[model samples]
Target: MKDENIKKVLLLGSGALKIGEAGEFDYSGSQALKALREEGVKTVLINPNIATVQTSEGVADQIYFLPVQPHFVEEVIKKERPDGILLSFGGQTALNCGVELYRQGILEKYNVKVLGTPVQAIMDTEDRELFVQKLDEINVKTIKSEACENMEQTRKAAAELGYPVIIRAAYALGGLGSGFADNEEELVKLAEKAFSFSPQVLVEKSLKGWKEIEYEVVRDRYDNCITVCNMENFDPLGIHTGESIVIAPSQTLTNSEYHKLRALAIKIIRHIGIVGECNVQYAFDPQSEDYRVIEVNARLSRSSALASKATGYPLAFVAAKLGMGYGLFELKNSVTKTTSAFFEPALDYVVCKIPRWDLSKFRGVDKELGSSMKSVGEVMAIGRNFEEAIQKGLRMIGQGMHGFVENKELEIEDIDSALREPTDKRVFVISKAMHKGYTVDQIHDLTKIDKWFLEKLQHIIDIDEAMKKCNINTLDKELLRTAKVYGFTDFQIARAVGLEDELKSMRKASLVVRSRRKNYGILPVVKQIDTLAAEYPAQTNYLYVTYAGVKSDITFENDKRSIIVLGSGAYRIGSSVEFDWCGVQALNTIRKEGYRS
Candidate 1:
């Protein structure tokens, strides 16, 4: 039955900000609360993270600064007696607690409906064995895996799957207690550790060299579905998506492959009866059409927030409406305002998301990129091309990298080893390899990154090489324009031509580059991310800057003065939720001062 009777809703918020799961949930949970309030529903939020803006005054009607475990949620339900409870807005923590509550019949006994994707569907996705069986029934391909209850069973399963398998513990978040085992010894060690976390372990064949791709799928209760966005991991399948450099509107796939994956994503969501947003991950081979469904996150995920920001689609807001019995066609696009939410977002630009790792803060920690997530935060950058987006994203990470080119001196001898091993600095190592005259084919053989992306990196190196040869005093407009087209910054160009040491010389070179670019009319124009690629008249304020074309889409109205507030970039250690709170307060202050923000 449609959930037309939901007048009061309880939202489970991600309790605390940690390494694997953080700020993304705050963004999502806040959006869900706003959507519920717009429908005139009284909202109760249960989140222990007092630092978040979601718990701020007026956001939630009733706020409980409690943990998001089953016991605490059951207490909230008993007291509040909410008409519905939303489990999808929170991270895996809330989903797990909700599932436990359903298993114990607390939700049933209390007459609370678990709105969004059902608890049974969540089980089918979370349980490795059940997930495999359900996908097999739908004829969707999955990697060969075995669920083992003990050490003996794990060894047997590993023997069946062969050497170099992956061990994953059931109910573990962020790929906790998951690792790749090359032989029996490694399998035994990883399995024992995994068993400590959960009762069952999944031993699966490793698709180490395959490309990791993901689709953000949204479905309504009426079976109408649409893919909001699709992303391609810059790093291959061995690394977790959270730790990998990701690009939106996949750069390597052919049209046929894109459509095939999109079809499978829709089919899986429909068969699983997911009534809201779900992220489906895939492992695909670039050489052939072979692919395997990795897994599905039947709730709002980190990828969901990235996809939403990259595409300018309010995923959590639409998902909340879907859970409240709204069909896809019935809702208007909040960004475009002229279109329905049923249409899939089309992009006219590229978005690059780079994971930020603060490994330097901790001592004796491994820096390898594996199935487990270690990134503290990530920054999203948009541009007219891949090179520009990646460079901007690197700068946005606040890691002192002006662009892709390395400023510090490193031994070229280490490039080959760095390429072979996956690390947080792999992209930099690849850049060094390209600068040292390594062929794309050789790097591809060593790193397993796609040749298309390798060529793009080579293009940046080629520009750097050209910059090295240019006379800084006589640098012309054409050269500056070309560099800007490939996403080169003035600081990067100055550093590239050996002017980084002498501050005066570097400043002079930067001024020359900036002046020449401006003289050549090479300034970036602001563009709106209307999700239509300018197919219709879009009335949205979501904007990005690109240097690709001559057209500008921004129209500044001088009639009303506006105060532009910049958000504190990606969340990181030592500087997090507090900045978000400040930004919100700034907007509130602007409104009180009678100015548009």
Candidate 2:
């Protein structure tokens, strides 16, 4: 039954901004809608989150304020009679809702075809053990793992695999109920927590301190596939990529290793038959740098936002067009303005993302980062040279001209000792190393970031030391702006200035982030990460990644606009602090863009 007049799409959107499932889906879902509308396709979006830009009426042909439940989506399905349903945009919530719709026979009863992936494909990729089996069939190097339903099963599995296993509760989000436990006691504690999250759990060898890499791949109905962008996390394999400070195009992978992982990404997408978009995560041994496949998310994810923003590829847009049977070649490059859709994005410079944590307010939550990630937001920085980019990124984070200020007064801590154990304050450890007069080369050998970036931060530290030693008060606005970018609070500045009211005014005026039109037309203020609830299972999480810009139509309150670079999201008890650094960056970027601080 090939209906020739298929022009409408039904979108299942992530609902509210709850704990586990927060706002990133809103960005992807919003982008998908914009892409569809650009192609003149009618879009019917059903989401309960009113705060999101996607739920707006103009973004879609028809908007519905509905729960993600299958029955509710089915009702929209019956009324709108869409040509097909797109489950690719929204996060796991939409996928699960589609699963229910198919299971309840609503989609079947209505004869509505699933657009991007069929019901069977979703089931195959989502079921952890099933996905692993499929990957094994393809000879992919997955971790030795098992799905256990109870305490007895967990013990038996641990005994066979040996101790110090990684436990992940099936269907849990953001590493909830996941940890590295050594021996019976720790295993029992982790198992209890995991099983509590879900009846089934996955136990495998813990691969901590390994190299963590993420790939964004897209495919079409014609079986043509292309790798869009690849990212590497600064934190070793054990930490979740989301919670790590990530750099795009990997600063350290040998060309061969990078290609090897890219090939695997293509193969997995083909095997799973994901037509539109997918994310593949890989873990590599730090010593040998050996690569092993982690899990393949069969839908758009947070990384997709970073990938799209970094590459200017518009992944969500191409994916939506692909779902409508448009081949990859038919979709043009949005950023490069190229006609060739087969080409992958190549970076002219480096892009880094520091995960922002909301844990500053919590007590005894263990600031240590680990095999699991616990950050709520992230910030991206770009540089032509590593050091300048590091400084720029630091400034972008509103951390007081971060890498530009010299003589970083650090509370010296041993980095290797810190790395051996994960902490929520890992960035501080990196900062402390720089403050200790460790050369950038030395830092790179230890931390795995480009030496170029380290050198830039070191330059800032050098400058600061000179300023303090010589009492150089080069009191220019530009100098002040640079200082502010590096994370210098007015209190700290006040310490140097002996001006309490000046510092107080600086805090009150508080910086706000605004975007300027880049030469490439990419808005600097791109999006947000809502990970406060990413760790829950089969629950809802919504993250919003929006473009912050201006019409040049200005209004002033007391001749000053109250602006605060909204941090990525709330740093829950388990989330880390890099995202706060991200918020710091955002504040600086706003000031740099000429917005009032």
Candidate 3:
């Protein structure tokens, strides 16, 4: 049941799309508004992003084109008198503004209830010292760190923690003011910058080479908790997750390791009293199986958005319902429309998220990625295997590269240093080193990337090498099928097998390869991403195309007028969520006109 007392809800929006925080909040905030509308609640949305879906008419009862600042929010709260306000749906900008309003007694003065994860819970997770203390209460392992208030305290803390520590600003988003310092001079500089962003800084021992893992977890007010998805960062702990390539359903972890982390994530969220959706990040020593709870985001985060899309679970929608005093068992899964929202989602495919950077658009910017985020946006690709998913993600980033191995080689004087110190081109560098006969072990040692990922990348290279010796006429059906299974696009296969130069047109060569592949009975099949993994029958239209499957999940209605709408794939400099808003609006319009979209 919905909370009848919350007749009017004030929804804060993350204002404008920028680096570190973009598009994901627009997606989450739109879902929240939809959920509120479903519950017959009057929603007042405050967002200055004019091109977002949430700012569109009919999304909310009232739309305020105002910045999500404390003063503006306080003024709106006084005028609107909403019974509840949702802070967790927005990104850090709105969260920080809501916290400021709460600090100034504005919400209390106006008698507005903060919905979803309580303000105290958000503060506990935002403050490094308090987060550690909260986790300590449950005997959870956390990174060894000291919270410092000033430069003097930071220096002393770094000395005590020893050299090569990471400095993180508390209450910052997307690792906003965070970096690694190897010496006193670097520590002083990093700490000063961190102090500018936040009043508190955390100096912690650096787990540079450990695997960075994350879990998207959800909990209800009655203490029912479930882990929706777990992801592994292709880059190790030194790089920020926003800057690294990420894979969902953790490809490298053993069953024991996966379960251990999953259980711990549930424990931490339950202990911290996270009422809705949240994510926990970890740094795991792969060999020792020891781990550190890096941090927990007590809100719908970027990872949450990816997890929701990766699985067929609507995290933001369900989280909004949970915030309105509904139990997990009481709510139905919106995608399936036939199951309870309490169960964990099981995936039958892999998802890879590659970050998109517009570094070249600017002049003289350092391209190296570190603890702080530099990626403006990311693309999530789904496939039947790791190789296919990563390659699709690489292409989806709109970088002019054919899947991993066929890309142009970078001019690196030192391959070892290029791998050791990560840049946006590190993935391409790995492929280059492979071409130069670098062993998987050597690459893994230098890059600190997992051997499983390296081997899969090597497999792609091995296939390309095999194809180099064969022309389109000589390429057998088995070889073509194998390439397709591993995510080689027709264009990539054509280029590899000497068809590109022969035809002088990539489109013609790709069409020839496609025709041959179709004749050989190798074609892409549609697969549904039902949360149940086919254990139970579900009718979710959420689907993806993969070459590994034999049959499509849903039969096509050839008689109906079906219109395909293309979303703006991956937010970049020129395009962002505005095009996504356009696509969604088009789909809605098509549906209203009695057409399938």
The best candidate by lDDT is 3
Residue-by-residue lDDT tens digits, candidate 1, 306-363? 9998888889999998888899998887877888998888988999999998887889
Q: Please give the lDDT score for candidate 2.
A: 0.68
Ten contiguous residues with the weakest lDDT in model 2: 531-540
Question: Which portions of model 1 miss their true places by more than 4 Å?
Answer: 409-413, 498-505, 558-560
Local error of candidate 1 at 86, Å?
0.5
Q: For residues 1-597, write the lDDT of model 2, one tens digit per residue.
A: 122465888998888654335556777787788877887778899988776667754678888998988878877888988878888688878888888888898877877778876667777777878888888889988888988888899899999999778999876666777888888999998888888889889989877656788999999888899898999876676677777777876777879888999999999889888988899999887567577888888778878888877666778878877877788877766544534566676665566776666665677787766555566656676544444444445545444433444325434346777734656554556666665666777666665554544555675565455434422144344444444444343333433343334445544322211111122243323222211112211111111222222221122357555475555433344432344434545666677777765
Give the Å shift of residue 382 in candidate 1: 0.2
TM-score preference between candidates 1 and 3, better one: 3
Q: Please, what is the TM-score per model?
A: 0.97, 0.76, 0.98
Candidate 3 residue 567 Cα shift, in angstroms, is: 2.6
lDDT of 2 at 476: 41
By TM-score, how accurate is candidate 1?
0.97
lDDT of all predictions: 0.88, 0.68, 0.90
The segments of candidate 3 whose C-alpha lies over 4 angstroms from its true place after superposition are none
Query: Lowest-lDDT window of 10 residues in candidate 3?
Result: 401-410
